[model samples]
Every structure is written in C-alpha cells, then in structure tokens.
Target: MRPALHAEEDVLLVVDPQPTFMALCPDELPVPGAEAVIPVINRILAGPIARAVVTQDWHHPRHLSFASQHPGKRPLETVDLPYGTQVLWPDHGVRATPGAAIHPALDQAKVVMILRKGFRQAIDSYSGFRENDRQTGTGLAEWLRAVGARRLFIAGITRPYCVDWTAEDAAAARFETWVVEDACARLGPDDALDASRARLEAQGIRFTTADTLHGENA
Candidate 1:
C-alpha cells in the first residue's frame, strides 16, 4: 500500500507550470504530454494538502542561458560557465510576456507563495531551491522549514530538468520528497527522464502517481 500524506507536514510544490513551458509546440522546447499533466496537477491541488507553492522561471530577455545571447550557439547546445555545464536554451519566460504567466488552466488561488527564479541576467535557475550557479538560493528551503513542511510533494513540467533538480535539492535538505510521476512531463530524450528517475530514487526521493495519491489504487 502507498503511504498517505500528512496534511500538516507535507507541502505541495508546483514547479514552473507557466504558459511559456506548457504551450510549447513540437518544434520548440516542448515537453511531451506537458498539457495533459495540467489536469492531474489541478486535481492534486484540489486535494486536502494544507500548503502549496509555485515556482516560476522569470528570465530576462537577454539572459546568458539564452542561446541567442551567445553568437554561434544554438539551443540545446552546452557551454561551460564559471559554475558548471550550462545548457543553452531558446529565449523563454521573459518577464512581462504572456508566456511567462502561469497557465490559465492552473488554479493560482490555491498557491500560498510564488517563487520567481532566474531573474538574474547572468545566471540560470532550474531548481526551485537554488540557482544553477549552485551558490545562490531562492530561499524556498527556509520558507518550507519555517512552515514546518517535513515532506514535499512535487509536480510540474519538464521532469528531467526543473522537477528533477528541485526534488534532488529537497531531498538533500532533509525533506522527504516525492515526485508525482503522472503530473510531470519530460523535455529531453527518453534516457534523460529514465536517468533522472534513477538518480532521484537513489537519493531516496519517492515516486507516486496521481491515482495513488487520490487513493484510487491504494
């Protein structure tokens, strides 16, 4: 049987469910089945969870993470930054753009906090907990701790990157973390998703489907 969530101790974390990501076309940086996961996430939000937070990738137009900022570089290519390997991406999540807004289908009213990340023009933030530079934090950990969140229930777009990084960091911070498998989509190759799952599992992060969370198969 699957474990049940303790409403007082667990918090729901929705990672980067913005229109910039959810509405991506096949030719763009589309996460396979990204749109289909929204309903699942909404259902989870409607559950008895006591607290919820949302992460937004609010990047600047000319952020270093954008391939366009670097001449001769293309999206999906990698460059070594002072921090580490940085993956170049098509310009996205520019502040004040319609795509940067949360998806219309999501119930934003349920969220208690909205953490905007990657606002720095020179740095990229993939994890809700920290910037890609690894030295800078978004203060999510401190907030979760203050609210007595002992476990984290995470769901959102592009599992291999954002979701994966957030889960890993949450686990490292000693919070029991679980990724709602059906509530996330993968942006990269299939192997990337598999590898992320393996890495998270090895780090002691749990996985459950939306059905299991809803007690449908429990």
Candidate 2:
C-alpha cells in the first residue's frame, strides 16, 4: 500500500497560481489550460493534508526580467544579466494588477502562508525559497523547517519552471519532495516536460498525480 499523507508530517506548496498565467490573459504570459490546475489543486487542498503555503510572483511594473523593460527585446529571448542568462518574459505578475492576484478559484482555506515573491525590480524569482540569482533567500525553507514539515507536495501553474525550481530547492533543503504532475500547468511540449522530469528526478524529487494523492488519503 502507498504511504498515506498525514497532516502534521506533510505540507503543500502551491506555486504561482496567478491569473497572469491563465488562458484568460492572452497578452500577459498565459499558459495553456492553466485554469485546469485549480480544481486539481483544490482537491488536494480539500484532502486530509492540512498545512499549505501559496507563492505569488508579485513582480513590479517594468521589472528587469520583462522584455518591455529592455529595448527591442521580445518574450522568450535570452539576455545575460549579472546573475546569468535570463529569459526575458512578457510583463507579468505586476503587483496590484488583477493578473497578479491568486486565481479566485483556488481554495485557500487551509493555506497558512501566502508568500509573495519577485516584487523587486532588479531580480526575477522562480522558486519560493530563493531568487533567480540563487544566493538571496526567501526564507521559505526556514519557515518550513520551523513548522516541522518534512514531506513537501508541490503543485500549481507553469510546471517546468516555478514548480520545477520549487521542488528541486525543497529537495536540496532535505525535504522529501513530490511534484503533483497533473496539478501543474505548462507552457512547453511533451519532450520539454520529459526533460524537466529527468532533471528534477536526478535531484531526488519525485512525481505523482493529484488523483494519486487524493486517493491515497481518501
């Protein structure tokens, strides 16, 4: 039998489930079928697992990571920043905009933390625990440790980026991490997804489906 998830032993990390990435926002960085993850995540939230944290991108207007901030740059283009090769993105997650808010459909009743990140104009944040530079910390790992959480189940919008990075960081921080595949939306193709899976698996991150998590605890 699969190991059952316990409330005190396990925690949920919902990464960047904002309207900015949903199909409704075609201009701002929409991920295909991103809205679908809400229900899958809601099911997980409604499950036996109790403690949870949700991450928000929360970027500022004209943030440096945005293509609009750099003249002649386009979305998905690569430019070398002080940190490393940075992928320019369409203006997204601007604070106080409707797109930056967490999707209204997501259940937050069990959420204990609504962690907002990427608000700085100079840096782009992908992981909940750290900025893109990888040196500056967000203190999420410390918060989890303080709360005595050991097993981490991550889910949310835009897999292979936010979800991938968060899970990898969680694993590196010594948490038993699992990524709920079906609960994550992606902007890439199957091959790209496969590549991310391999990369994450190599880092000791495991994968599961939302159905499996729900059924196991049911």
lDDT per prediction? 0.85, 0.89
lDDT of 2 by residue, 133-170 (tens): 99888999998989889999999977888999899889
Best by TM-score: 2
* Model 2, TM vs. native: 0.97
List all candidate RMSDs to the true structure. 2.1, 1.2
Q: Supply candidate 1's per-residue lDDT for 52.
A: 79
Model 1 lDDT per residue over 101-179, tens place: 8888887666888999999999899999989988799999999899788998899977889999999999988999999
Task: Candidate 2: list runs displaced more than 4 Å.
Answer: none
| Residue pairs with backbone overlap in model 2 | none
**Candidate 2, after superposition: displacement of residue 177 in Å?**
0.4
> How does model 1 score by TM-score?
0.94
The count of residue-pair clashes in candidate 1 stands at 0
